[model samples]
Target: MAAEASPAPYADLGGENTGPVYTQSKGDTLAVRGYDVVSYFTGDGVPVEGSQEFTVRYEGYDYRFASKDNADAFVAEPAKYAPAYGGYCAWAIGANDALAPGDPNVYKIVDDKLYLNFSEDVATKWNADIPGFIASADVNYPTHAPDEHFQD
Candidate 1:
């Protein structure tokens, strides 16, 4: 017997891509990930006064919130505030000359750990080696900012 096929795409990124989630309700466009104005997370959730910013605590030190709401309202929007890519290191993807976005599904939730990765593809590649592309990019990314990893 053969295995059943999944209807979803291999690389969904939880949304259309690594941008944000939006919905057309009654012919109106609404930002799903809250009304913080910034498409930080996966998008298409709800809107809170200050739930638009983020502060990913990973790799030992606390990465300061990039936005005011992310830092102030994370407690209220934990899932809505965490980065999509597990926070492996966005700069690394930008450096590798690959445009990769974080994979919400390919995430690591540590009791006191900040999950991270290069890109969703790289994360898939990482399965081959626990510390695969991550270690590689750490060595070559500084020389190049490749935003081509997460191509639609």
Candidate 2:
């Protein structure tokens, strides 16, 4: 999904990472698997490529947006647009409470929050117990970083 980051358009954003928990698989790269975090909420939940024309660097990682408006919206409220569990797989967060890279294409929006999973199979399991799993994820998320453990 157009995940490359461009340095020029991000001066407006205070160059920072989204959060301590945000996933930067392979050590360094763009956030949210390179998908536009705002699109999951505003659009049909389908992963969309973010354009370099509209980008921001929050916390430390860079995020791309499909348009200036979307980028502005994200800049206004980063926590609202950022994914839960450090953009790790929601199902993994709930189940194993361990770290796994969430597939941008496989996601669900619950309570206006964007949730992602490692795969379609895992997402199915997560969908079945949204409330229960979220409870687990909520409790387990803060203590550890998704990348701390090698296991998925």
Candidate 3:
């Protein structure tokens, strides 16, 4: 099942949300909607809900983990685990230069990086041309993404 998303709090930037990370709402610091990012790479390769007990702050966002080991793993190399494009829907950023909420339940690991999509349908579109989209997003994200966490 898809996780519930919080109401968007920031005003749209030309009809697109602009930020370095995708939080559910303004003033919310939880990354990946509190899903364990490390879990996406470890063990069964299935994402698991993180515990508040094991949380780490990185790049101005709070990342939760299912266990201390996972947290430590994240701390060791955050860039390795952080979702590409700050957890925004990969296809959206790549195809549209738009910031759409990335569903943790719908994810893909590409070139050893975790990438999230808006939904299964978007994932389908993304899967069609991964390399091309990545190239476009690579050029678009830096231009569209703001340096700050939240920009209104």
Best by lDDT: 3
Give per-residue CA lDDT, model 1, range 77-152, as digits (tens). Answer: 4455444332334434434534343433344333322234445675555556545444564454444321222322
Ranking by TM-score: 3, 2, 1
- TM-score of candidate 2 to 2 decimals: 0.82
Cα error, residue 98 of model 2, in Å, equals: 0.8
Q: Model 3, 1-81: lDDT tens per residue?
A: 999864442211122224478888867878899999999999999999988778777766777889989888887888899
In candidate 2, where is summed lDDT lowest over 10 consecutive residues? 16-25
Off by over 4 Å in 3: 1-19, 145-152
lDDT of each: 0.36, 0.76, 0.82
Query: What is residue 65's positional error in candidate 1, in angstroms?
Result: 8.0
Residue 18's lDDT in candidate 1: 30
- TM per candidate: 0.31, 0.82, 0.83
Q: In candidate 1, how many Å is residue 43 off?
A: 21
Which residue segments of model 2 deviate by more than 4 Å? 1-6, 9-24, 146-152
Query: Candidate 3 clashing pairs?
Result: none
| Maximum-TM-score candidate | 3
